[model samples]
Target chain A: MASKTQSKTTAEFADDPINASLTADDKIELLRKMVRIRRFEQTSLKHYHAGSIGGFLHLYIGQESVAVGSISLLGDHDHVITAYRDHGHALAVGMTMDECMAEVFGKKTGCSKGKGGSMHYFAPDKNYWGGHGIVGGQTPLGAGLAFGVKYLGQKGCCLCYLGDGAINQGAFHEALNLAALWDLPVIFIIENNGYSMGTSQVRSSAHPEEGLAARAQGYNMDWAQIDGVSVYEIRAGVNKAVLRAHEESRPTLLEIKTYRHKGHSVADANAEKYRTKEEIQEHMAEHDPIDFWKSTLIGEGVITEDDYKQINKEAGAEADAAAEFAIKSPFPDESEIFDDIYWEVDNNTEAGRTGRHFFHG
Target chain B: MPREITYREALREGLDEELAHDDNVVIIGEEVAEYNGAYKVTEGLWKKWGDKRVIDAPISEAGFIGMGIGASMLGIRPVMELMFYSFAYVAFDQMMNNAATCRYMSGGLINVPIVVRGPANGGTNVGATHSHTPENIFANMPGLKVVSPSDPYDVKGLIKSSIRDNDPVYFMESTVLYGMAGEVPSNDELDEGELIVPIGKAKVKREGADISLIAHGRAVVSSLAAADILAEKYNINAEVLDLRSIRPLDEQAIMETVRKTHRAVYVEENKPFCGIGAQVSSMIMEQAFDDLDAPVLRITSADAPAFYSPPIEKLQLPTPEEIVERSLTIC
Candidate 1:
């Protein structure tokens, strides 16, 4: 109850104007974060079109609010691991956009020190385990991390994020069973973008499932569904889930219902063929978390339209600057190729010595 | 300094010694605690160490194996037993991606000091599904130390060393040799602490001049038998080298023997193609080409799956007679 009250009331400050619990600076910070993700995604799409970014590039456009809301609820000490659609997640976790952009550009300045490209990005110093490319790969790893925290007698839990497609994997079941069996402190987030690659949920499933959290029933886990588009909803949902996991030392699965505006990747030939334009328009009107946040913040007098515009402008400039830095950065040297493939062996003394040592023991 | 004991008893003693020494050490697997382990390698451990350690895990390999990795990640040294070696394939994903590579993936953030022990190779009437010699698979994987001890002495020393080492070790116990008796050094008998057989080192079982014979796991015992036959009948004193660990192969020891002996013969229980023998042979050619007096020879199982028929199985596998004949021809 103490944790629930702490998390739920923490967000009321931004929700209620009379209470004024959230400071003006906090509101500005939130706006800046959302704007940063928005600008980064837009510019990244341009880079993708220009063939600067190859491989599978899944833009975090409509789902920006989820990262903003959930990451806002987390502290610097908290750990996070996520699926391949991870640029926004990394930025929210406090990695510089230039490093992330360069990582996407496969430049040496990337967050992974340029070894791991966009998908496999890992920044352990910042408590980000990785940007795992495999769908359900992060669940067991996240659970193991939480187990480590608990065993070491630490005060942190791991927030493991995956996609709607990943819940069907065997690793998800194995991870959840172990997490529940051990009562590990972990927050499992399923960002349900309503499609597994090009196939719709209806096509993938035999029985129509309402939310990703429903599958948690198979493992007898604590679960809930939320409107992921709304930053307020995501914040409230994650805050509750995270606190519950930490306090009870139990794993909680939060299924955030959101939609991706673009196709699964850049190579979708007939993106519009899968779904009707009417369905897209309907979601845009009913469930645009960005639009909802703007109206709520404005209506509550938390910020003005001019403030929003200035934040957007600043974010755009920052994204442009990051792209410029990434493009100008030098490619990795050839000498680096042989290094870091494995742990370097230090045998400098033996290097100069040619003959064998003859000793009688 | 040596007392006779079975391989199974030696393994049990190893677990007992580790638990007695380290408070962080724990044992988990199917029937490992209450039922005295599937192979009974952990007999009486539960009574001695209590239930907190020496846990009896459920029938979930992935779950318990992942738990072992999780526990190891937090400084708990867990020695997990997969009842049968063939079943390890179920937990291969966790073993390979998580337990094996966690330290490297985490930028050497921590070490995984976990030992997965089980009985491998087929001598029992168990079907093809239940019987598989997967030493090559574990040997092929990086970030893992694979050790297969042939006798009680090596078993006790290697198991103790694996528990103390700061790497994930896979100890494949041969079921065929579990009942076989051999001398193991006692605690009071040893002047120092427990004997630690270094990883990636080979032991020379017998010395000879004509040809060198390389083997590992249970095949080491088989090779010794073959070497004696060659010495008695063929008048060929074949040098026998027992490769204890396969991953960081005792290449130096192997090369030294091959170069001196002038002829080499590799013996293994598994099939010949792409086997550990192939790796050893290629390395010998690469490094000791000038010293070789004759072509390298290999004695291994045929390119066919092992079946129930003992007569057929005998024909399929390389025996002492075959080894002596091969040694004479090569010499």
Candidate 2:
């Protein structure tokens, strides 16, 4: 007997907060981050259509606020790992637009050196592990990070992001069970963007009504359900989880309800096949994260009409510059083929590249 | 000071020694804590290191394996043990896609210093579902380093090295050889630190001029036995080459053996089609073709699911008698 209003269960965690106070600067910055992500994705889609970008391209247009709000709450030392829809996540965690754009373009200066293409965007220096291509593949990796954090006595926690589609994977259950049993400092974030590829959560999951967060009680875990369209709510939910992780060494399952404005990927453009255009338009009008946040900022006197317009314009320009940088970047050299396979001693993967040249032998 | 030790004990000793040496090193798996490991390879580690160092994971291979990979990226060295390598099939995406590609795809920015060790060979009549020699499958991946040791001495030295190495190393052990004993170096005999065996290096267990018996894992022991028979009965000088590491491949060592013994006979417990032997034979024909006098012969398991029947299962694996017989043709 679960209700759609999110209060059917006693775990309406998004309503309250443990010190979710945000400064004016943090609010304005988060707003701009959302804008930057939306503009960057929009630009990538435009280029993908023009044949400038290749491969299965998934955009983080509708789900910008989730990544921005959640990551802003974590310290720079904390780690963030997510699924393939990660352009927004990478940007929110302070990845340079030029490097990310170059990565998607498969250029040499890309974060993954043009080898990982779009599905993998990793920056270990920034503590953003990478966006995994597999649906539930990165679940255990979060546990690993949390395990390391506890083992080394580091204060940093781990944030694991995944789509609603990944909830059904056994890795999710296994990871949650261990996370709870060990009381590790890891927060499992589920960005429920309505459909997993073409199938909605209702059709794919066994217990979809209670929200994926409801299953936390089974593992004796703490959980919250966030209205993902609201950046304020997203921030509140993550802030609470982070506090508990730091104080009690607890893991929480936070389900952020959101949607994808675009198709699953650039390849899946036929949105009309699954649902009506009216539903899409209605969601854009009512629940668009960017629009919702923009109105809040303007209403609260955070910015003027001119400021809002400028933010969008600047994000668009930044994305343009990134695209230019990526276009001009060179492809990797022929010698790069035999590198990064093994590490002999230190972090020198390119070692023995010349010595072990089997082609010469 | 070298002493006789079981492969199982030798593996446990490596885990114990590493746990004592590095605080970042942790052992994680099902039955590894209180259950003393499914095979008793980590019998006293949990008691020694306590719960924080030695952890027992849920029966979720994909989850814990991925967690191990994630932890390793953050400077934790996790030696994760699977009850059987067949269980790894559940976590293939994490093991192959994530663990193998993270370091290379990240432009060498991240390191996955995780050791996924388990019994990978088939001889226990555990049926098709439980038995899987997947070294070739893992070795095929570029960013991964595959290690399959033959004896207690090799297992003790190499498992320690696999733990120390800053890469994803798949350590393959055999259930049949776990109880078997071999001479291992004591602390006094070895360097001040643990014995470090280099990955991707093949060892010549026996010397010969007529033919080379190249193998890995349990097949190495069988090949050594086969070489003894070939020397005593057939009057053939058969060289036994133990390929401890599979991925970096040690192409130079393989070619050196091929040059020494012109005839080659490859033995593996994995299936024959597209197996490790196939790759070895292909490499020989490509690089060492000039030295080979005959076609590279392979004695692999029958290309089918491992049967539950003990006798049928025995026939499914590559045996010492079969290796000796196969070497006769190549010789």
Candidate 3:
């Protein structure tokens, strides 16, 4: 439960103010989301291994708290755009599990209507930008969304999530400077899972001493990184940043320091070569966000052992049902291929008067 | 109140009018404000509208261009200006993948009404890096609309319409024609939407029968000039067809022109390799094959980057002399 306020990853739940503020139902609901994300990702991983889904599949197992906590504080007007590690972000933005899973299965009923696979899922109506495939690609778009909020005179903010490697990108710095100069409402979230696919921060970044958080100082913006293993702590960190973004039209660089239990993607075969199995197991056993919340709930006597079991069972069934829906959904028809390419409104009555679209020479 | 104005002034008027017409419209780019734009196309609008509407952005094309796309989806119509068309490579991903595809990818749930306008031709001896006519590259995109206007009248009308369009429009301008004076109607002289040239329509700059000279942007000027030379010297009557919109390519107009002349000469400022002329040449071959009296000729830039030297650059792009010669050969 250690967070920005507590300033210690070693701190226990006694000093965690978020827990005292939230009700038992609230805490259980957060746990349910974390469990659902874990189950959904686990099921997706199993299917990828079984060859149900084609292309690279990036799981959000150990880093569930970042999406669960950060999304909880966002209003419906607030937007979210993240890298391909985005199943958790999609679900958190209120996309149905079936829709997200159907996209993974490349089905017609998918959120992106099967055009965008797992790495390119989008649900704009839900304010979720996309499941962008390119690393560090979503950084500029994040600032762009915030610039919209400012331009439209909307009292809202945008949360842009990217990996540790994204901060090194020139566009990232450019976006930060633009956001700060224009006073755009945006939060740049560096989800530092400590590796750029296979290479760790030690091998990737220039200023790895202070980690990704230190670079925000170069942009003259407020910055912080928190223990991403606790959803409560993650929420607390994002709460201040989001408030800062909306109230003052200030952009913040908030890094969620966590680890992914799986390889970078289903195709990352050499993950073990870069990291040891013992190191992986140790993070899973100790810093797992889902397990941490589960024990915290039980220790607080918020839920019984049976209740926890029931939650887990429900989460598993939901993930299984989502997969089943995706399996039953049909592939997009050939005619549908040319349908959404351009909106039909422009083809209708336009502003200009030349009805005939040609000049007879 | 029809009066002569420079193409740059006409374009600035269009942006200024659009900004006044709709609160959602804003001009965003480097030097678009305090510096009065890279080419002075947005000279006084920044002072007129202030920083709220006319914004001066960093030299980060990818960042601001992407931001413009995002802002447009949320109902802010962004007129993003790249210093040159070649700079589109910096924000190519956002321009192609995000802006162009957002409407389609979101199942028509989102609309990106952003106009990316800048000079696209290479006649200033700026070399290969600064001079690239990317009409073919952008027109190839499905969801994105590509517009290129020739005269001041067309530029004013199309730029306004491109800003108001409910789609991502890549408005390619000509640096060579920026200061070229042309007759443009005053706002009081024209009715609403009358001055606004619709996308995807071709204009008949001149009518003839011997050959058809088809082009867009600055090449349209050469095509007209070539038509005059062919008429005066060779006694070959050439019809000049200026394609205002590249994407919604007026195939009917092309067929009409080819059918009238029975010979077609496609000219463009872009390189010959996979240029707009190539597409038009094939379209005439496939669609209006029976009407053609001779093989369609394409007069485009040399299949290489622009030369730094003025003399070499002059030989690279399609010239009026070359177009006249190509037209004569085809006729």
Candidate 4:
């Protein structure tokens, strides 16, 4: 079983050796990435309301640190895959805001050529597999990515992120068993954001006190809990799992206590009804990851309030430009609908010409 | 001369040849590696390839199937097996939503070069839960390629083509036909590409001018037997067209057969409503309506769950008698 102990708060967390090794520039870059994600998500919500970006917009507003911190520690062989709430991970792994926003806008220049909307960003060249849409669907894929890394004799791990609600899914549990049974190099990051859609964690899951990661004990895999409010703590905690994967080819379950300020998606009309406004406001006021990190940087004399404002402004401008670029980009042509359905058909190989690959043609 | 081999041996030979052909190819499923396959189709593969190439997974279809799709995205060609095709419902989301759509959804950036193979047939007294023919269900999806080979020759060639095709191919086999023997190319002939059957190409198993019997998988065997009975008893010459691939359907072959015979009878082990025969019947009516001399009739399994009683179960699936009776009406 997972330990029932509470996660250490940012203030309670001791000096992070990983943070200590980071140069002043590296620390600022982490802060910048978080702010960039925040601004990108906020802009997406604004456009979503204005009827520009269609489909579900699962914002990564409050959980930016988890993606930025963990992804920053990834080596060349390391890979990343996540569920629908994936804008942060996409941007963290070097996917440009223009391509991502274009994808959300359903433009041809988008990362997925506008075929996959907000929930399906992919950059295989960068080792970012996808932004899978189904709940608990990407968990098995994550384990498979690790299996590929191990099979190819690569020295790295895969960081598969899922929500607290997904931990209850049968696929996720099955993936955990396979990862442990095979000793694959993967870290299942459960971003426990207090609520799954309308239901709170206590109502949706069992053993809330023991934490979701405790279920890792059932698989005989290592488990831990981390304070998601601190980027330093997230990096330190995930770094340990990455080392275990690289050196031992083992799996770990890390339950990062995080919070989401917005609704499950921009269209979740009952976001306020299910959870009290006070609860949302309280978390925003005290446990906001961005504010906590910004203040910590200021206290350390690495950055001032003026520098934070400048960074925020730049992120906002960059997001605005991306949205503008998405607006200007063209949608894919009608002929393109049948293009990517098969590799053989797309490349016009000898086998491609033999059959009626498309129904209409 | 090509050597005779059972359907099981042909599949094993195909897998072995592919594993030897490419280092990235692997086999993963429950009982696949150590247990030598639930049906013994993978006998001695574990010893030949060792554990790295042949892996055993728990009875977790969604986990391992989705894992194969993921690995395929990273340049690994994984051939995953389901102990029974009826168990595909457990991993339908992964197969339909992920493996089928990964390439299209990824804008052609990722290719899910994975083959999901298993026996899909009824009439074995395994009850309803274990018997299901989902070729039509999978063929309905746009991005998926559905193959249901009837004989050992087609099975060996199609399995190889499916593995190398760079798409998600759902290869539906038959447990009843696993032991059936048919002529297959020798290993030396295979090396020179003698038995490499292409996808979406139908074969004229037997030629006649009176009627056409269109079928796939085990039903092809039934149809061929019916053609003999039709010629011997009723003096009706029937053309048997084996529709080896369902999704990328060989419309040209179907039309040619229809044009030659001017009458058609579709047969399959699948149920009738919205089945593969239904699609073919609709296509003939739409494209070759003038070529037809009579309405195209269909003979299929009884529209109910597979019966557990061995005697009744034998009558539940399509048989040669059913095919001959249905063909007589169309003729």
Best by lDDT: 4
* Candidate 3 lDDT tens digits, B44-95: 8888899899888888898899888777767889999999989999988888
Q: Give the Cα error of residue B101 in candidate 4, in Å.
A: 1.5
All models: lDDT?
0.76, 0.84, 0.84, 0.91
Q: Which candidate, 1 or 2, has the higher DockQ?
A: 2
Best by DockQ: 4
- The CA root-mean-square deviation of candidate 1, after full C-alpha superposition on the true structure, stands at 5.3
Error of 3 at B279 (Å): 0.9
* Model 3, docking class: medium
Candidate 2 residue-wise lDDT at A231:
72
For model 4, what is the alpha-carbon lDDT of residue B128?
98
lDDT of 2 by residue, A1-361 (tens): 1123423221333234432356667667888999999888888888889998999899887889899988988885588999899898999889988999999898998988887778889988788988888888888899879878877887778999999999998888889998998888999999988888988777888763667888898999999888887776777679888988888899999999888888899899676677678878877877787877777767667787788899999999999999999999998887776666556533444322312322232
Model 4's A-chain: what TM-score?
0.96
Docking tier of model 4: it is medium
lDDT of 2 at A50: 91
Candidate 3 residue lDDT tens string, A242-289: 889888999998888989999888899987889999989888987788
Per-candidate DockQ values are 0.27, 0.54, 0.51, 0.78
Candidate 3 versus the native: TM-score? 0.95
The superposed Cα distance between candidate 1 and the true structure at residue B137, in angstroms, equals 3.0
